[model samples]
Target: MSQYWELLASRSDDQHTSEELEMTAYRLAVEQVLYYADRHSRTAYWMIERYEREFRQALVPLGIDVQVNRQLRYAYALPKHAKAGTASIAQTVFALVLRAIYDEAASIGQLTEGGEVLCDLVELAEKYRLMSGKELPTKGKLDSLMETMKRWGIAKKSEDHGLDDGEDMAGQPYAVVIRPAIADVLGEAALARLVQFKAVASANDEPEAVTSVAEEGESQE
Candidate 1:
């Protein structure tokens, strides 16, 4: 067996330190994504820059299609055939919210300058309430969803590392570093559809239907 297999077999055990794993480019590429999971992160980008070919050679045979956008300075993965699972309603709503926020921020050069926009959970809830006339997810549920977003590389907790769960976080703002990757994932066509969806949903009071539309749109991608 190759050293890769040896490392894989021993990965679950305490046989290798992070430093050891990062020594090999292939190992670094896999470990960077599997553990840290922000492909645009400094370390991950560095690994991709230095070892992208090795990364592709390693992942392709395993049914993981990897994409490296050199100009954009990011890399990502998709399963073979690129079929994606539909997100839950809450997740879809959260993604839309992020997309809206990112677009607004990008227009004014906030995100373009690498400055992150702060997304207050309380304000987000208020926005959702105003849009849907329905209460947003409870504090705990929203927090859980935020965590999932963090893992998915959509956002990151701010510098202050605000409270994890709070119903009254309106005053205390938590920062989220939104990535440009959202635009890539959502795409321009889907965004146009979402714009229409928002207008119609807002007018017709059918915000719940947004999830189904989003699912259909994603499936076509």
Candidate 2:
């Protein structure tokens, strides 16, 4: 197994507090899922389940519903249906790219500030080590992808002039706006997966538990 895999497995046997353990495990799971999915072309649901079963129980208690299979289908199928006339391969690639970006942004708990630019894409691709077997996209292809995203309202671009310079910059950084509708697209499954992963990871590290933290602090006093 890879070092990462070993780390994840060993984490299951750690004696850290529950919260600390859970956080470590959650990060590992997310990184692993992204790595595995990108390499195997597996759907998000599969990644979710793989990590969920190992790390946490379920997020239902947090008022998040998780519908596993439905989320998988929607995550994979919607883009195809959304752009019927376009090249299926391109559409699919774009959808996966967007999903990866959105997932990373969500994990970080904040959207990027660059207008219309999904900054996470490059980071995710590098983390997953995804390289197009084909040559890099031509300018036209990139433009088409941007246009499709804009049309779908998944992203938008705007230019703001710098008052200090009193100059209108050409092609200023684009800000990519993520639609709230994306949450509906993945449904409750995503939340459930996150919750389950958290729980399982926490279980592995007893010291890291929330209760343990409180107890330890009290004992120190």
Best by TM-score: 1
**Candidate 1 deviant stretches above 4 angstroms:** 1-42, 68-74, 84-86, 112-115, 126-135, 159-170, 192-221
What TM-score goes with each of the models? 0.59, 0.33
Give the CA lDDT, 0 to 100, for residue 12 in model 2. 50
- Highest lDDT among the candidates is held by which one? 1
Model 1: per-residue Cα lDDT over 1-221, one tens digit each: 25653554365375443443344434433332221233335565655554566556767776655555665466655444333344555566566667667777788877533334556666666766654444667767767767766655456565333336455344454645565656644544544544543554432223232333223334436
Model 2 TM-score, all chains together: 0.33
The true-versus-predicted C-alpha distance at residue 137 of model 1, in Å, is: 2.1
Name the runs in model 2 displaced over 4 angstroms. 1-87, 112-136, 158-175, 186-221
Model 2 sits at a Cα RMSD from the real structure of: 21.4
lDDT per residue (tens digit) for residues 1-221 in model 2: 14434555465565333454344344333221121212232333443444454333333333222322333221111211122233234433443345445666777766533211244233423532242222224456656765655444344333211122212323334434443334434333332332332334321222221211111112222
